[model samples]
Target: MTEKISIESNVMDERRTSGELEIKIFNQSDKTRTALKKLALWWGLSLISVLLPVVHFVLVPLFFFLGFFFAWKGFKSEGQVLDGKTTCPHCGNNIKVGKGELNWPVTEICQSCARVVRMEKKEA
Candidate 1:
């Protein structure tokens, strides 16, 4: 007989340390879009900040703070890789697959076994 583990306890522990949580990326394309948006926002804010300094000292600080805040958020946030590791079915060897690159329910030649191995993304 096999023991079944509780999903709540095994998957999500309350006392787990920070940075241990799984970073989930729903769509890989969204990552590129988000980066471009942040770039545009930072550029606009920087131009505004530069112009504000000529107007008044008080406004200069406010614009500078806002510009720095957006820059910090844009560059500092950690990103998750869409790729994951799995075991090859044919030769029992480990393989890495990327969600953005491969289509689900597809097969590929395994390096170890030299056999066609099927890969599918499973939902949790």
Candidate 2:
């Protein structure tokens, strides 16, 4: 499911700003579904690569192995960031953070002023 969380952003200049972030946490069934989808996509690519002449020798095997690897990774994933809006500490403009795998201390570039912003969960 989705959760709203408080976050803090740090600018290169040492300025800190507070904001909110939205994240998606996958349940067991969701993880399984994601893993299956990833596996199907990669395996499908491998099947398509079989139509290629000499490239199939390399691509087919690569995609076949990569499918299992990616599926395992997808199954292990706990959550992902959906999106977030935070103030750019440097430019004082609103910055939009894109989706990404769930990880602490997410780093993003400010679109308004092109400054780097480091984001982390806000401590109580």
Candidate 3:
């Protein structure tokens, strides 16, 4: 059986002293993520509108409004980035990742082991 270690978010920062790399990941819940995606879509459309001068005036404002709406929805939604860490199963080293890269626990590339590993939240 493989030993499992729990990493507490309270104790660790972006960088660890034990040769762990700092990474940024997403930590929002499904609803929040969906809302954020809406915001992103708004922004994308707004950007694209800028390229089309004929529709810039109308599309830009429209997209901005939609983006704000999504932002508000995401703000009201529950769930946030969980504070925790996981061990690199391949190299047996501690790995730190940002909350942005996580969503219901996902697989990520480990810097130390140079292998893909599933990163999950550790209950404190």
Greater TM-score among 2 and 3 belongs to: 2
Model 2 clash tally, residue pairs: 0
**Relative to the true structure, how large is the alpha-carbon lDDT of every model?**
0.43, 0.89, 0.56
lDDT by residue (1-124, candidate 3, tens digit) is 1123343222222432222223333245655676778789899999989999688999999999989897776655434443335666556666655544324334446778676565444555
The lowest-lDDT stretch of 10 consecutive residues in candidate 1 is: 2-11
- Give stretches of model 1 more than 4 Å off: 1-81, 98-102
C-alpha-based local distance difference test score of model 2:
0.89
How does candidate 3 fare on TM-score?
A: 0.40
- Provide TM-scores for the models: 0.30, 0.82, 0.40
Residue by residue across 1-124, what tens digits does model 2's lDDT show? 7999999999856689998889999999988998999999999999999999999999999999999998998888777889998998888899888998776677888888887898889998
Q: Could you say which candidate leads in lDDT?
A: 2
Off by over 4 Å in 3: 1-37, 40-78, 120-124
How displaced is residue 57 in candidate 2, in Å? 2.0
Measure candidate 3: CA RMSD: 10.4
